[model samples]
Target: MYKEFMQWALSSDDSWAGLILRLTLGLVLFPHVAQKLFGWFNGPGLRGEMQYMTTKAGLPVWLAVAAITVECVGAFLLLTGTGTRFAAAGIFCLFIGMILVVHAPNGFFMNWFGKVPSGAEGFEYHLLVLGICIVIMIQGGGKYAIDKLLQ
Candidate 1:
């Protein structure tokens, strides 16, 4: 069972699936980051949201800054597949922190609704991104990724 699971998870084929995952995660997350960094797409912008996260949400300023840095600026790296593996690592850690620190109080574990489990406020998306990041990390960026050129 373990061997089969590892085999499936580590398969080298990353064309369609990686393309879909990369596009979807990047597009879905881009707006949120923009909202935090810029006022794009009816977003709150960096100053406002980061302030709120610290004051209203009681988050440490550094953590808030890190979130802003990762979600907004770091997202560009992920989208462009420029240093894809490292960008994915940042995103994965960010999501993990969000789950443990922010959402866990709402629920201890993910609400197993789909392949990538969700939480009280649609953690499904984060989990999906996490899975995609994991896949991409192991297989590396595919087709149009900058990693290909570098390699």
Candidate 2:
């Protein structure tokens, strides 16, 4: 079982497409993770995020912590092309939750012009990220990935 799991985890193609998708997703996610984890980019950081999640978002402390951990660790894994599928899966689920919980009422288009009364954006960005994650989950990490080395 362990061997099979490892094999599946390490399996990947040699195409550049995986590399491109992996890097794009990784890079895009990094700043968001940093904001939540390190307070960078004017983010609320750990404590603030926790309070908001538990209060405004009405999430349990454990789920908030898990989400933060997944965002931080998953972004790093995606960047290195290590555990690409797992990382992508985590991110995919995270975005799905975000869309359903936060963005669904705002509709599909982003509030580019601040026209929305709620000032909340839509799910278009989440959908795009979800699409990227689906591709990465299917293709694995492509060229220059650590998964290739492990295999």
Candidate 3:
């Protein structure tokens, strides 16, 4: 089942479109990780922001590092088509964790307006991204990707 899906996604001869998808996803996600790592774009920055989140969330420090690497560094790898599958898989895992830990509290509807009994959070958006990354992980970045050229 999985292999078939991957073959389908990579079936596109229009490598440019596939490349665009890979680049967009990778570039867009990096900022979120950056906020925790470098505090760029008004982000909280790693030392204070990430540490605080780790402390509050009762997660380990390495978890923060892993998330940062996957969302930022790994995404860059995806963009460059270097280890595309590995990077996409890493992102899939990270997004799944976020859906469970962070966004799940927001609830499926993403109704931060105190809906779903509050603290319900949401898994909707994070899950969506996770699914997409999972697809890319299995399919690869398509023919135009650096991964293909490397092969």
Best by TM-score: 2
Model 1 misplacement above 4 A: 1-14, 108-122
| Candidate 3 ranges with C-alpha deviation above 4 Å | 1-14, 111-121
TM for every model, in the order presented, reads: 0.75, 0.93, 0.76
**Overall local distance difference test of candidate 3:** 0.70
Output the lDDT of residue 47, model 3: 84
lDDT of 2 by residue, 30-131 (tens): 998888878999999888999988897788999989888888899999899999999999999998988887789888999999888778899999999999
90, model 1: CA deviation in Å? 0.6
What RMSD, rounded to one decimal, does every model reach?
A: 7.8, 1.3, 4.8
Candidate 3: how large is its RMSD? Answer: 4.8
lDDT of 3 at 75: 75
lDDT of 3 by residue, 1-151 (tens): 8777544433434356557667878778778767777788898887876676588666788887777766877778877866677777788888788777777665577765665654555787676677767767656776566665444
For 21-136, candidate 1 gives per-residue lDDT tens digits of: 66667778888887787888887788899887898668899989987788765578667766666677788899887876667566444556544433255365567778988977
Clashes of 3: 9
